[model samples]
Target: MKACLNRTIAAAGLAALLVSGTLPPASAADPGWHTSSSLIGTSKYGDDFKRYDYVNPNAPKGGTLNTTTAGTFDSFNPYIVQGNPAAGFAGFGGGLLYDTLMEQSVDEGSVSHPLVAEAYKYPDDFSSATYRLDPRAKWHDGKPITVEDVIWSFTVLKANSPLYNKYYANVTEAVATGEREVTFRFDQKGNRELPKIMGDLVVLPKHWWEGTDANGKKRDIGRPTQEPPLGSAAYKISSFKAGTEIVWERVPDYWGAQLPVKIGRENFDKRRFTYFLDDNAAWQAFGKGGFQDFRAESSAKRWATEYNFPAIQAGDVTKSEYPTTSGQPMQAYVMNTRRPLFADPRVRKAITMAFDFETMNRTLFYGSYTRTDSYFEGGELASSGIPQGKELEILEPFRDKLPPELFTQEFKLPVYDTPQAGRENLRAAVQMFKEAGWVNRGGRLANEKTGEQFRIEFLGSDPTDERVATPYIDSLRRLGIDATLRIIDESQYINRTRSFDFDMLALSSFAQSQSPGNEQRDFFSSKAADTPGSRNLAGINNPVVDALVDRVIFATDRDDLIAATHALDRVLLWNYYMVPQWHLGKVRAAYWNKFGIPEKQPGYIGVDIDSWWIDKDKEAALAAKYKGVN
Candidate 1:
């Protein structure tokens, strides 16, 4: 089936998008609607006008850009660390020193041209793949990028980084074929997912990193530095002032400076990232002009009201309008299928049917979100319009495994928003309880045998979560079910979810990679359920889902692969593994207006870093306009 999907896409018109420098013809617009150009050696993004080399001949570069995420960074080693602001910064910061062979476009709609490699070739069967590197690819220190570097990366990542284990577990062997070539062979056949996986794997250098192991064996190259390390990229870490600041200077002789993938993206020669433990302090810095620009999360009220502050009203600040679908990553209440209460598919379905997403959106999110019905949303991959005849055939055996009402529009679960839908869903909840042997006595549901009341705790973080969750708690109480909301700090929240120690909790799965592989197993396979910090929020372990995940990873072509993924999604939906939640219609973002962003808009599907560029003219104009300003 994946072959068909791939064939259809290949036949549709993406060939033009893949080719560099050819103006996208008007006749080629339909089927490649979601496809973006992947122009080689430059940032033009194929020949699409939307992203044609948008160079401002007069635009000067040199300014500071400030952004904020959820937390502070005490650790400087983002490569080996799992979760933290430093890791987030490492994604775009000075860490690109060990430049990767390739990178995904900011939006992830298209692939970036090779940075270190000239091209990568995959076997038609996908069991083996090879990379031909650009001999010119060199580290900042003038050492050439070679096959040994790629192998060194594999050895170090597999040995030390817990996060690296997620992407590297499938590899059976990685071998250096030549000075600038490397090949990887997988343990399993029919798995064409390695190429996509390699796109996200950051490479390390062999000359600097290949060292003796703890046991002193020459082949035992240890894990790469948990702190700042080196290789070749646009920026190199200069110094990190303990708890306050991290500074990186541009590599004046960056080997890939002219590489298409690095061209417009890393224009800034130097980047300085500051840290503030408190969000309010960060906001104050932006207002006081301590930073070049601000990229931080904000409340809608603050977005609409606070921007009118004197600093903003005077045009010292500006906001960019960026929108993304809600649950762009699916985060909501998930039931652990490995646990007995939810092991029964009927119970999972019942829980989903009882969720009121519309109310949650309206009340908690200020109607700024959309409910998600599938793991894939707003794309052809979503099952919303797929021909379900075949899927229904696959679902036949599990017919009795799920309740009858699930196939209908009435019982379809939506993303939570408000309290009304919660109340409305209680009727279905009561029915599910009765069927599950939870007999209601005088309006209180009690276990059929033990007479103990059915009570469960909803574990999560965020103080505002209670605004929407409290209403659901009320509804559960009304149905003779005891539900309570427990809010904790972020660390505790992470520990709880990582240990599989909670009854119910909220989580969102965000895949920067559109080509799904490891993430599928990470989320649904029994193997990953107990793996600390993996994303299997529901802790699901059905053989059917496991089979579907394997099929997806194995399929070489497009249609069969998508069919497998769709099948897996359908099964998960049928089982009600997650009470899917809202998706942001757009990326709700806040940024400072003083900086001049470049004209090369990432072809409409923009990413945070793609749209940023220093505007010297804007800064000059602002300086002329607000001389002696705060």
Candidate 2:
């Protein structure tokens, strides 16, 4: 039924039937549905396959699972420009309360299974992609999901949301060609990731937004709203106390319940989220078994020191660590290059070298953290040693724009792993600062011409972030840099960060992909530099970075992909745009013992409880034994 079905069929095995004149008319040639994305080669399971291997297909689904968060959510509209959506708002324990066209498989990399759409078709050149919606797909209110909904979703998202607009920049248009078929045309061709990204579109119901409210006012999809939105997913916002707590209940007549992809997932009958204003308060509430079922420990100090509560001792709370093999988090002291002070590469490098990671790890972190050196740390894609092979070839053209030392020398952060650590590093940092036209004057580093004292403010939201930043601030002060730390409220931080209003902030990019596609644009593209809310926090607008980002996105094969990514990683590292922070390979988590998890867990840590179900026996026994605890 898709616009590209005939072309896709001709490229497949069905071409022989048409060529031999054994097939009926072109209208009679029914196209087969796909189980995964086109570039993923083959689905691990055939068309007749059962549920995924990592889930418990027969697991019973009925129990209230509770979760805790530090910050209160102001609105339910996460898709818009304003407000943070509550966690677990979407059914099946993911994001927002809607279904994407296709869902990616957690067990396998780069694979996606149909969710709203039963099948999709696209040409080999990837000029366009078409999705055929499942006839069974329907919204929470029982309206059938149509091609109109898909088109409307694309239109509104691109217009209102900054993230969505930048993400879908290359996508030309989305058109509903048939009752069941919706096609997305791309501006650029031969990029295989286009089709998969099109599948990732968040389909919003058209009638709901255009409809009149109880007060006879039309709802604005562009603004944040407290009114709960309708979704086609497995769960709905059953009840809420606004910023305090949100509870989701399972939809009895969920359309996707019987689908192969839905089996063994979203096992909870009632999922709830309770929010606290502070991290410590949330931690204490979780420790005392006060309206929380699961807690992921963020502070290493707390994980090692403070998990000695009565619940933990009584085995009511189960603590565990899952080693992560996913893309490394690039948490960094991001230097704003738009500011004149950090525009110089030498000054940036000097600032990075001045930080004392070794001493901090010894005293503060209790030796649990690892000093991160690469943007793509702890992965094969990470750039190590010197670039060679195809990676070297990829960098050849951009050699003039890149750092000259990238070809001749290897990139290494100044090691403060020995004695005279503070003095030695500070000396080198002072020398670099002097080279950048700043000198120590009146016990402060001042600009040579302007006489402006070198000062930087570490902007943050959490009060506890000061502990992590204070040690670094002390080190910077030794270099005669007038360093200061300021903690603002959550809303202020979010608004300020979006507008690029800060001297420095510890930021993290949560983007991870086995294929590393177009999202790279939002992260490092020159176009995204001026745009607010982009992940390009350092305001990187170099042509060299832009070129490398394109190379990473349009890579032809696995070899070419790795080569380009490595090259990009090297250039980013040598540039010293970020003062490399620390990373942990695993997530430290603690949850109640009243649930049954899957026999096999996915490589990803968050999926450890994806197939978890309430064990009635354990629940009943715990209730009898520990009465009045929760």
Candidate 3:
């Protein structure tokens, strides 16, 4: 799964700038300072650039945005894994409650502009990075944001959250170099991405968190709390009803409201997220207007057949697919290797062969998705055909350790076009299982040594996943395997998955960026596998994978990063750690026609809800239509 805090930035741009002789070579003694950063190429926006091209600076803002989430939340804090965090509390670009050091550009893959920090400087070697906080930056209480707060936030996050621990592992220390300046030092040099990623740090208020609450009890950063924390962002938590709902009110005098990055964003006066027990309930609420304003459709079955509502028929609602330039996430049924039953790669491969994605797509998905083939699908970094050149060189040393077929053949999932072909694949799967010391004895597949039945359970929190798992389970049973699907509550699911307590997850996704880096470690590294609450759900512990992850992280240029990622992807595919599912290239969404969207949408993130404004005339018309119907 993708880390909630993950954001992309460019590193190759610095190298290109040095090569072009546009700037003098920088070193520790003479660092170059800039207002923006990028990891793949030069930042599209320069020092004089105003707002992003995708936003409308003139758009008026005053309406409320009502959205719904499928699960309940118990805590306001999203930084720690102690409790389920409320939706919109925190995510990419600091969500609604907090502002990060920099704001990510939705249209660019690997670029970000200053938000809290006015300017930043880094050496040629990227050993350390320093940021000068904007003097105008302030918390809700009107106190200026300090370097001490930046240092404290980084120190506390890295020590408490496993996700942050793995992400900032390379960052050694944060020190106050000046009254408004803080520097983050790295453990090693030559990592161009480190300086850029530091821009993603969500700055927390040191004074408020450490101070006492209204009850006179000291607040703890590690514990879960319902009391809304202080924030520097455009919105603050105004009200909540435990697991039922949460509402955010935009700050009238938000300190950075006029900043370049915030000019045309956070357009809504209020943002409310209503919680439902499941997707079906949420869908019903969305159809009954006023309960929900926007819905991002995830189920193909529902999107294909269930949009005949009155609002949609009357043109009061708009349903459309928005194309995106973002990388296709790896959505799959993840098998936990830490479990004894899935310890062998051969057994995992046999199990994967039983899944008939072609049939599933035709019947259940309405042919809306494409079969995923790589960990980094829909991106140029995905490995295709056979390994050659740099990718081959990276894998040469591990030739004896890896599967030989991986080197000779292109990796592709088994396809079952006909019933006969399906049967043939099943037979092949049984034979492979037999070679791995499993056999069908008296019509039940059991281990030859232990005589234990090959039982597996697919766990899921969503009803939609259960629909897909039911068919897959039937296929597994045909092989004489005891397979079952278990649908649990959202809270229990989170607790169980974090502790690696499940045999298999019905759905686990690994979201990728155009410029992959440190986040790869949390997804595939051995250290992450051992860390509770980390994104490494499969528990991959291969040393070769660890080495390859480093290669991707420490890659010096864009080409080197792509080649390294290709090598890593090939190795991961050959391991059969998970059964690849399918993905859609476009985001399917339905929303009321009362909002006005910008002429251009962000290419990388698709729809930018923050850039949208309420159209008064349309809102009035929609209200009149609903009144007439009533």
Candidate 4:
């Protein structure tokens, strides 16, 4: 719910429904209904608009899109927190198996178009919202998508997933209002985002979930399963090899294929995801012409030095950077405050100060990355130059509870131009730890009162993370802190992070959006800190942060929202919950030169793979060039 528009793929689902007699016309007493909604401003497209400008409406859809995910998957279900779900099942964006009530537009910020529901209406106060489902919307099994399915999905998702529970916490109830209409009533009014977020509801097939499986076992929605759940989306699981691979076959007769919103999207006839143990294995597979056809390279080191393979030299592959207008993701070394070792802000700040990002950028990243200073990095919402006016007014009341420097000083990470300066920063960090009841005893930093050694274990799932973690761990060792890096498998990593068992995460990313709303609660609220599997990985529980989160969520206008966000960013930074990392403003991707990209790339989403199609001519040329090579 962190602005559904931030999702990489809008779960494409909807059926060709009858145009006439779906529901009764809106009453004169009712507010004007809309086929689309926007959080920041008026929607870019009207009701009669065709496909998105970023997609090729005439794109031919009959090629396999092979991708890779670094990790094994135990369950096909992504809704539950109990297991590692296969990639593409579900994510920030809608999943390949399920479709949301509304599909987000990649080209726009916080704008959503109708999918399952044709139109939605809400009063001026926005206490509640009513959605009119498309009459022709049908499940893959040919059953009509009903109000029952909608209501059941909302109830079950909230009950099973902590993420969904926190996301829809304000929505009190979902009840059927008509044959194909369901209304979601909120606990309070004036939350304009509630109605819009309700559009993100991913409707499940109630009958399929409730029915017994082939083994005649009662299906449990709360449990993990590998049975490949029923789906209404454009693709379905065609085959899967336990933890190694999964393939989704495009539905030749997908009901929504002709829908305006989906006309040129989901172009691939087959989508296959092959799993690898680590980044090296995945990269090797790509070099060997394995299942991977495209990759969005995340490691700057690799992008700078590893793209000189024979394929690149032969012009069989292309690497490019796409500019994005989306809010930059705050990737950081997250310290779990639940642990006694990081309980003190001074201690956390001390730990953060050890991360020499300036040196890392130059040595490891090849100067390809920019240091991230703000939680809302690369965006207008980032607080800067000492808050004043509206932002200052929002933070003034909480001055007594916040760090005094927050109001006086412009918050920034210490920059070091020389090795001596970096060493001085480390000395200062040690002093901070000393002030927080830690003392150096025989070269080991220990708690003064308890005589406990400060031992920090940085948990990571990817082996590639060691390139960054190794130096930071060495830095901590120089300070006489017993720090180590634990690189575990993906499964163990997921399980450990869920229970807040890690001392600090080597790397964790929080994706932000232009409009920060209800999702902020799940990310920074005290309640979320206590909720296992919540996005509040740092265990942020400050009342000032809680209050600021609410202010951002309830801001009535765009200007007010930005001001509130600036205040929130300021407070979170001053708290030193995590070590700010770096980000690339543009997306760096390398792929075989067999796909045709759109003429106009969306500014907000940058590269939408769903809009790209296999160019038959290019693919044939590549096949001829690599004939017998593999």
Q: Pick the candidate with the highest TM-score.
A: 3
Give lDDT tens digits, candidate 2, residues 187-238: 9976656766677777888899888778898888877778888888888898
Model 3 agreement with the true structure over 63-99: per-residue lDDT tens digits: 8888877678889887787888888865233668889
Per-candidate Cα RMSD to the true structure, in Å, reads 7.7, 8.2, 4.4, 5.0
Q: In candidate 2, where is summed lDDT lowest over 10 consecutive residues?
A: 13-22
Question: TM-scores, in order shown?
Answer: 0.79, 0.91, 0.94, 0.94
Higher-TM-score candidate of 2 and 3:
3
**Global Cα lDDT for candidate 1:** 0.55
lDDT tens readout by residue for model 1, 297-413: 434434545566566776667666554321134446666666666666656656676666666555555666567677756554456543366555554565565445444433356
Candidate 4 lDDT by residue in tens digits, 1-630: 011111111111111110000111232135877786666655567557677877889999888898877778889777777888887776443588777898877777677787889889888777898999988777888888889999999998898877778778889999998888899999987776777778888889999999999989999888999998888889899999999999999988777788778988999998999888877788887876746888777778788888999998888878988888776777788899988778889998888888888888888888887888998887788999898999999999987998888878899797767989898899999999999999999999988998888999998877776887898899899888999999998778888888888888887777776777887887899999998878888899889899998888777677888899999999999899999888777767789888988887777766788889999888887778876221
Give model 2 RMSD, 1 decimal. 8.2
Q: Model 3 residue 347 lDDT?
A: 96
Which residue window of length 10 is worst by lDDT in model 1?
1-10
- When 2 and 4 are scored with lDDT, the better candidate is 4
The true-versus-predicted C-alpha distance at residue 186 of model 2, in Å, is 0.9
Top candidate, metric lDDT: 3
User: Which 10-residue window of candidate 3 scores lowest in summed lDDT?
Assistant: 12-21
Which order, best to worst by TM-score?
3, 4, 2, 1
Better of 1 and 2 by TM-score: 2
Please give the distance, in angstroms, between residue 582's alpha carbon in candidate 1 and its true position after superposition.
1.0
Clashing pairs in 4: 17-136
